[model samples]
Target: MSTTAIGINAAIAVGAYFMTVRMIPRLRDMFIKANLAGRDLCKKDKPQIPESYGVLIGCVFLISMFLFIPIPFAFDEAAATDALTGGKPATFPHDKFVELIAALLSICCMIFLGFADDVLDLRWRHKLLLPTIATLPLLMVYYVNYNSTTVMMPNFARGVFGTSVNIGVLYYIFMGKLAVFCTNAINILAGINGLEVGQSLIIAASVTVFNFIELALGHQVESHQFSLHFMLPFLATSLALWKFNRYPSQVFVGDTYCYFAGMTFAVVGILGHFSKTLLLFFLPQILNFLYSTPQLFHFVPCPRHRLPKYDAKTDLLHISTTEFRLNELGKLGRLMVTLLRSMRLISWQELEDGRVITNNFTLINFVLFIFGPVHERVITQMLMGFQIICTLLALFIRYPLANYFYATET
Candidate 1:
């Protein structure tokens, strides 16, 4: 915290925000001109919206990293001295620069996949596996720069285990799992206009707040400051995207936005060395992921998109699920569906054609089940509101709540 450092970071954040905001229209026009729009046949009155506008975030972020942020701050004297060549000054951002490069490459890979999916319309299998590839670069970086991946136990349990419980090499596997889950969580819990980008914005803002709080508390200043570096640009660009991507959207962020936003979190978590803390902010996304796991794993028929059923007259949305015919299933299958329907876990609707309709298995549908039919925007708000509450709860639990259950690991 020097004033100079504070001023420099603030300038970079403000400048990046404005630059990205100004460029969104240009990016949207480029997508539209290139015929990059989503097929909107799934929902009522939904129009084809321009896709891959999320590339603006990557572009603006990388550009700001290079153009504004200097290589060596006052914090890099040791590096500067180590590189005391014939007056070739130390490079900026220190070792973290390498992590930035890895993050950029990984994000580019994700954006490429998203663009391919948008243009070529790849299937679920491809979507599931491609993001794993995007994470390889980031994961490799984390492996090379080794650190603790130990999960903290309760104090008494830690005494028995001789400190934090180390999961050993299995931590890499866990990181890989984190990467996959983060990439897909936001992607799975989306279909409406603002829900995708809105959640991203909220998560970014939450992380930003966490970073600032850490900085203010005089704890891990440099690391939290580094986290802010990513969070600020993300929040900046996402706010601009949200304006056009809101209800009655001018553009569709598409799979690209989800892939990009999710991986951004992955990058920040890995590079900032706060992966555990980072994961806490994503509890809602994680819960939604868990809630939808059965459908995602194909226990039930998972539709390409779990968009709510829109009522034209009421202007409200209802749950949309796959239904099975009685004749198509054996006794056990029929019994299972019957029980789930009775529990209201799955809805059963009688069709005039002697068939049945079942509610879609997703958090969006679950919200409607609890709250009854409501507008899509309301659903977005409630979910986003829940995300905010979860994030604040995470903050509370990370500190105050820890006094009872467990100690902070690092």
Candidate 2:
């Protein structure tokens, strides 16, 4: 089978998976009005339909297999040429069968997990166990066909490990541990409504950009053969899932979808031979997590807990305690103050004592943003720019924008 056929097939399968998942909410509503015994199945005061929605979605993906599997595969000659000529074009693996199998396993695992989580509310232990078991075949396939050398300081210092090592016992242990970490990280981020979906967009965009860079470098064979095959399909699946996952979310992706998506990404990074690049793709989220770590450890207070939970939904760790505690001011006044505090335009103590504290924490993030990547590469520069923009926007824009929409209602 050709690379083009595989790419097209994967796209269709993912598209179908998302389209079907989107129907869950509507189905739930119907079930609830009917006074079904399963009304309790939906947890959020919102009705939940049967696990049949998952089955249906899985079926759509299954049908795509028949549609895509048979077409004669052909590589994208144009993409190959572009890559060789130092122009970026998205490319896929020459061996379509391996990718096809990986995608199929991914879809199936997602459907299974989605159904279980939606109906049963599976425990954390079980969630870990199930995905770990499912990830083995994928790990095997990845090791069999891909290189596992740790490439540090690309095009410079590098360590080459034989394919024999990749196929050995030790590689499986490392892959298993990495898979669990990534999948859980995605699940943790999926805790809030719209957060996972929003973050996924950023990740997908980054990966797509990386793929474009690889293509432009005219090294399509190296990039596409080992890496993009998995990444592209994973990105495609996430994009399709986002349709159902956006605000006023119709269907929660549940553990199933999140786990599958995370595994796909984790495996792709491992195979791509670009662990460092994967870190770059996830930079924003990593920073956010780090910023929040102090609060998690009780080193600092989280102000959102002091406010009405719904109204305080967007509060990050950086938000000050004073603004969070102020209730005498009207909602609009409170919003303006909170906005200022979040941006680090004003200190929490200043808002509390009616005087600004001279020192602040905002600059710490700014400095890290500038120096983080330790390189002058285009991607690093762009990321640094994003950090600055995010800092400014968080301080100056997001609050006002949020206030405009939520003031009266909250």
Candidate 3:
């Protein structure tokens, strides 16, 4: 593609961004009228705000995709851009078309699932389980269309054990797991105002930037094209949501945005054939999920909302704690708590009444733990900064691994 093509593509992306921003007010009003608002529980005032603007955000992305890369009958731009085709229909790679179709189907599945969760206020258990079905198309496409799910072992492992070991069918299972984890990981590491979408924006931007660098360096063109197409729209809608969701939020995105945003990334990762690189980009969210696994598994009692305690007076957020009585615990419980405390992932205070309060296990709470009590806004920015740092680190690390273990068209 030439500079003129690049400029045209960018204009389309900017138009999508502005279009989503323009749609938010109407969506906000719609949520309000439907009484789908949620209280800003992190704030002292606990003001009600309309929720699930992701509906429109998803709309913008899907619509933009149709316009930007139309299905055969969707539109005809052959006359304008197909000088080389010379009246022959501009043809897309069959594999690329299949991947994009699968991606679109997967994202659509996620959008409807998110909307249902937003309206139903589904439980965490249901949230985890429901997105599995949404990922079926993604997994099925990978198996039928892409076919090979075998992953090569790391370079170091190859030197030690032999040439790269194929993981075989397990790789498809891993892809399915990746889809579920990506969707839920974002959902879990959220609660702070704009933190969810803010981190998402940074991740999308980082992936997009990395894709461009790969392109400029002359790596695989098709993979990079798929990545840019998926990410540009995701970044646009996320930015638009952040506009309303920042600091003092005008609207809450609820679960709908989280599902849509996360699944979109998953689709890009799978279709672009950069799923491992994609996981690297989400290192922070992955770490948060691992850190919170004890609670997730019921080793520790998990609260419906584990958000940091917000003090309105100073506008600072404090780490919130969950109570677990040591006396009520078995040997396994005592050991788990001690291990987490030793890792400094949690701090606990034993009460005279036999209950112990353990700090909330999340990246947001962990930031509060490390930085001390900071303004809610400050913490949100700090976490987003961590997101950027992690993503950049991933980019730097990916090339070495990809070159040695995963060969690509470069």
RMSD of each: 3.7, 14.0, 3.1
Each prediction's TM-score versus the true structure: 0.86, 0.54, 0.90
Model 1 C-alpha lDDT per residue in residues 97-155, reported as the tens digit of each score: 66767877887788778767767889888877887788888777777766566877776
Ranking by lDDT: 3, 1, 2
After superposing candidate 3, which stretches have Cα over 4 Å from the reference? 1-8, 71-92, 400-410
User: At residue 132, what lDDT does model 1 achieve?
Assistant: 78
Local accuracy of candidate 3 as per-residue lDDT tens digits, 279-308: 989999999998887778777787877899
Task: State each candidate's clash count.
Answer: 6, 8, 0
Candidate topping TM-score: 3
Model 3 residue 135 CA deviation in Å: 1.9
lDDT of 3 at 159: 69
Q: Which residue pairs in candidate 3 collide?
A: none
Whole-model lDDT values for every prediction? 0.75, 0.48, 0.79
lDDT of 2 by residue, 10-127 (tens): 5765665565556555566553464332321212353442222324434454565546544433445655577789987656554545755674675467567756775677766776
- The most accurate candidate by lDDT is 3
Candidate 1 ranges beyond 4 A from true positions: 1-6, 39-45, 69-94, 159-162, 325-343, 349-356
**Backbone clash pairs in model 3 (N, Cα, C under 3 Å; residues 3+ apart or in different chains), count:** 0
Please report how far candidate 1 places residue 329 from its true position, in Å.
7.0
